[model samples]
Structures are given as C-alpha cells and as structure tokens.
Target: MAAILAAGAGLHPARNAAAAPMPRVAAAGWAGAQTLLALGVVPLALPEIARYRALVAEPPLPESVQELGLRSEPNLELLTALAPHLIVADAGSVTSPLARIAPVATFAPLRPGRRPAEAAREATLALAARLGRDAEAQSLIAAHEARLAGAAERLSGDRGGPLCLVSDAFGNRALVFGGNSLYQDVLDRVGLRNAFTGATSAWGHATVGLDQLAALDPTTRLVLLTSRVPDARTFLALRPLWRTLPFLREERVTVLADILFYGGLPSADRFARLLAERLAPGNAARG
Candidate 1:
C-alpha cells in the first residue's frame, strides 16, 4: 500500500458491429500489440513474443498469436503467410519490406510535448476506429482514466520523497528517466515528482555517470527498475560510490518490476498502479 489502503486497479468487451468480420491484425512492437488487445482485438502475429513477455509482461498476448522473430527484422516470409488484414508497427521500427507484405499503419506511443498516457488514449481511439472496435475502446479508455485517477488519490499522503526512476547501464553509469519521459508523466499523475529535471532524449532518458546520481538531493528516493537487472542491488553495491548515495544509506531505495518505459497507455497504467502499490511509507519496498 502507498498508504493504509489498496491502490486502485484492461482491455476488451466493447465490440464492433456484428456484421463486420473481426480484423486479423499483426502488431510489430509491444505498444501496438498492447493497443490492439486493449481495443479487444488480438494480433494474429507479433515479433519478439518472448522478449515482450519478459520485458512487458502485461495485457498478455494471447497464445494464438504467432511469434514473428526479431522485432527489428521480423521473418517476412512467415508474416506473409499469416496474411493479416492489417499490420500495425511502431513508426520506423522495421524496414520497408514490412509494408510490402501488408497494409502498414505506424504508431508513435511517445510524442514530444504530449503526455504518453494522453497520447495513448488518442492512439487507442484511433486504433479502435481502424479495427472496428470503437465501443470497446471507449470502455477501455474510461477505465484506464479512472484507474490512474484513483491511484493518484491513494498516494495523496506524500508517503515518501520524490523518486529517481533509473536502471543500471554498466559501470557506475545509469539510464535515468526524467524530464519529459513517460515515467515522468506517470509520476506526476501519481503525485510523485521525478528527481532529475534536466533535458533528456525524445525517448525520455539519459545515460549519466555516478557523478550525476551523486548530485541529486539527499532526500530524493530511488526507484530502481530491476526486472532488467535481477542483480541490480548487488551490482549497485559493487559501485565505488554506491555506499555514498544518501537514499541507499537511509533505506529509501525501492525496486520496481518490468515496465515498457517507452510504451503507451498500457505501460502508463502499469507504472501508475505499480508505483502506488509498491511505494509505501518507510523504505526499500519492491513493486
């Protein structure tokens, strides 16, 4: 609990006109796959199914969905065989050949200046329209908005300090989420502030050395994204300046599970809920 109560807590149910045949969709990356599921449409195929499971683990891809090899270079022959009605991909995620196989629609989950969650909402509606799942999309969107709002209210007590969302990137350096990242947006929605304010890449993070981490306010809390680094705690301990981080010494560090940091509504919803659920008063909690 972020407090004395449980934090507030998906896809599908609303449907398109019964006369229309359900579209057979193939999604290229995690974001498109998530949107399809949320809109009550299952992808016929997606690349990197295993990696998507290991990295994003949510909104669950159905067992019927075929795996299409690497996301960067999906097996074109197999995709052609699937013969999906439509292929949804991240903009510029794959090469031109993907378009040659089937009609391709590109989605950008993260956009400059706009909140990812908001962007996700618009994308969901748009995708729903394309998939003839408009009714389901409205239901999903309404539910998502409510869940996030409830999570925000649950953490109104200010149980802990502002958080530094980060993951290890070898040596003493870290890949930090701050400034305009999707994590930053979720943190804001959940009533938490991001520790780093400097500008970051369009994807919303920067790789900085231990010197930058050392410069954070002493009271800033640390929330390590550990799904990518199961031994993150141990690895951090090995850093020369690890013991010097004030939050670590004070036990104000927390660990969070996997999140598609650059993903869309599904990831935004996951982050908001997980943060409120995992972050409670005191220290060293794991979400």
Candidate 2:
C-alpha cells in the first residue's frame, strides 16, 4: 500500500541530485527497464535481460547490460557490484534492499484505483524527466497515440467491433483480462470492446474455469495472449465446453505471442500493433 502511494506521486525522488545524468543505472523490474529503454536510456543492468530479449523481441537491450536475475528477487551481490548511481523498480516490488546500494525510484503501471493505461503514460513521462529526456518522451507518446488512432481508423468498419475478449490460459484455469486491465484501455482506444463483464482483482484479472467462455456472447471473439509451454489449445482440447464455445468452433480465436501485460508505454504500443494486425472483426465473423 505504501508503495502504491509512492507511485501515485509520479517517480519517487532520487536521493542524490548531485548524481545528475545517473552515470550508471539499473532496473530491478521489467517495466522499469522498458521505460528506461523507451526514453533511450540504456540501463547498465536489468532483471532477466536474456529472458526479456526472448519474450519481447523488438527494441533490444544492449549486450553490455548485466542480468540482475529475477525481477522479484534481484541478485543483491551482482547489483551492488554494478555500483549504479540509480536503480529503478516497480511500485509493487520490494526495493528496500536496493536503497542501501543506490538511489531507488519506483514506477507503477497499475497504481491503485487509477487506470493502468493512464498510469503507464504517467510513468513514462516521469521516467523521461528523471533522465532529462522529456522531449524524447513526448515524441514517443505522440507516436503511440498516432498508432492507436491509426488502428482505430483501420478497424472502423469492423462489424463486431466491441465484442472481443482477451485472455491468457494455464492448465485448467483462464486468466480473463477486462474492466481495469490495460488491455481494456487499448481495446477502447482501438474502437474494440472487451466482452468480459466479470469482477476483476485490483491488478485487473479474474481466474475462472474454461466453462466461463461458454457464458460469453455467441458472437464474442477470443484473442489469446499465448505462452510457449502448456499451449492453450492442448489443454482446452481436454474440455468439452472448450469445444462447444462458438469462438473456438468457428475458428474465431486469434493467438498472439505473450507481451508484457503490465509494462509501460512501449508495451502498450506493442499491444496496439499486435491487436490491430491480428484483429479482423469482419473477416473472423464472416468465417
């Protein structure tokens, strides 16, 4: 809760103003790394940089950036060795230990009660300010808005525009994203509607059985943010209800590669591009 409060005020103040330009920087959270990258600031270290490279192929981090292990539990020894002037972490992450090593600034894409999408934008701007890259940040934000608007224009003629559902599945459970999720904001930006009307947790997801898919509108389109292992199709095949779902039987399901669901503006931009490219409402409905 205190972390969320800290995030609401934009980035928490960096302790050492004398360390302007932050000669060496490191990010303890994936979202923070993405924000720094978007601002054209190459952090000296990032959590799971290798895995991040594989997951989000675009906008690669430099080879020099050291891997700081898991985002949740960063390698303190390796991180301290870097001797970074600043370290960025998520508002929800535990960063007390990092403060002892360097100045810590927190960013939160999902600030409590605030829309995740809006919070992401604010975080991006704040991050840019930290690095004295406000101009670059504004340009990036403008480009992002243009992309969203362009996607909406292209999908304007979509017949079932607002009846789309986005989710990720694992084993027998489905993590349906809607309501306060950042995806919902993207959907609205692109003139598409989220079909899930169920209650969501503060982070904006509801875990439900596959049978819940049957409860959605018959015309609803399902776009899956798929993972590599335990393919959704493999597990869904075991459930009779999965087969009975209209979207599945009619071949109206679109599977997209997993992107950072809780990342900053760069991720939002990636999501918009992926959704616009894969989502063809008229084409799917006709098929």
Candidate 3:
C-alpha cells in the first residue's frame, strides 16, 4: 500500500501537569524526559543538559536541573545523591541499576502495528497514570493534537513532493528513518509522504549509502536531523560524489534543526511546526 494511503494518526494517560519541585523526579533519556516535561514536571536531574539544549531543543530544560554526566552512563553516584522520589527513563531497561535508588518508570519506543504517535500517546498516558497525573496528561495530549491539526491544515496543500528524513552523510552512507519512525508519523500527520521506502530495523531506521539516496525521485527533499552526526553539508560540499545527488543540484534539500530522533511527542511537535513553516507555499528559504 502507498504510505499516504496508510496514513492516520492515539492513549489513557496523568498528573496535574506542574513544574513543582516536590516529588523530585529525575530524567534519564530523551523520550521519557520529554514526556515528563510535557506533563509540566521538570526533572531535578538530567544528563547532558548542554547537549539536550542543542538536540531536543524544545520544552527547554531549566537551569535548576543538575547535570547527570554522560547520557549512556549517567553518574550513578550523583543521581543517587539527588535522592529523587521517581526516576523516569526512556524505553531502556526499567530494572536498571537506578531501580535500587527509587521507583523507576519508562515509556516504550515502539508497539507492534501501532502508529508511532499512538504509541507515544499510550506511553505518555501510562507513565502519567503511574505519577497520578492522568488529567494533566490528557490536557497535554489534547494540546499536542491541536498543534498537529493546525500544522496539517497549514500543509494541506501540496508540499511540491515527498520528503526524506535523514541524519548526517559520511563515506557515501547516511542514516535514513523509515515508515515506522516518529518522524514518519509526524510527516504523515502533516499530510507529507516519506520518500525512503526501504527496509528498516526494529528502531525504524537504516544506514544506507549515498548511492541509494541518489536514486530517489528528484522531487524528494532532505530533512537532516544531525544529532550526533557532524557537519554533513560542509563534508558533502568537499566530496565530489555529493554533487551527483539531483536533490542537491535542484536545491530541494531542507536541513532542519537538531532533534532527538527517538524523542516523544514534543519532538514530533517541533518537527511538525518546522516542516509547516519550511514547506508551506511561499516559504522556500532555508535555515
């Protein structure tokens, strides 16, 4: 079936959505942390605060949050010292070593046969139910839906063509998100289509060479979510083979701001607004 034909965008999810200081919650990963923040709960401690500002870049992290060191290896000692009442992590191991410190909560990244947005909605609601914030979570989800609806309306007209969500390009290869990714769901929500129709892993992305991208329809535009990937435009500018891409020659590429590819609804919202602003008619300038 065509991706546009399959397109549709769901949860019981929560708390009173406040940024209060009590109950001292700590954030672990991008998605879960974002979920909590959307519920108006500011994490007492979050890893890589500086990097998150650049990557996640939305629902801004407060200065009150203590740095938890590396994202992969959160400073257990500091996190323990923080003595949080709850630890919310991304869809990683819920029974992680942090479980010993306090009750842990998490959100799953993917649910079989479920739309990414639906899974996100369910996970947010489930997590909120744990925190006794169902009402607040509902409000948050409603607001997010309203924003997405506005974006869809803004992009109701043709965007000229489909888009390809990708990360940095290197050595003739690039990370491309597939139909099951959060990016794909957001694209679908905004009435946009994904151009990369290839197999992907459980995480919904694959590393394919530039040769694969060079073969895409000439109308496919690129949206680079350069998280950890280095400056691709500069690198590709110096690579002779990069010139072979028709999208580049025709200037159909649209490099987006950094985003946590695996983040929750907030990430999707940021992307939705960006796409609407960039791809809407009479809006062809790049940032």
Candidate 3 weakest ten by summed lDDT: 3-12
**Regions of candidate 2 where Cα sits further than 4 Å from its true position:** 1-22, 161-166, 229-241, 281-287
Model 3, C-alpha of 57: deviation from truth (Å):
1.0
- Per-prediction TM-score to the true structure, in the order listed: 0.88, 0.86, 0.87
Per-candidate count of clashing residue pairs (backbone under 3 Å): 0, 1, 5
Model 2 Cα lDDT, one tens digit per residue, 66-151: 88888888999998888886788877788789888886778787876888878888877776666567788899889889988988
Which sections of candidate 1 miss by over 4 Å? 1-18, 229-232, 238-240, 281-287
Error of 1 at 52 (Å): 1.0
Model 3: per-residue lDDT, tens digit, 189-272?
Answer: 788889899988767789998878988877888777765434446545656686678777666667677777677688888988
lDDT of 1 at 29: 81
User: Among these predicted structures, which one has the highest TM-score?
Assistant: 1
Better of 1 and 2 by lDDT: 1
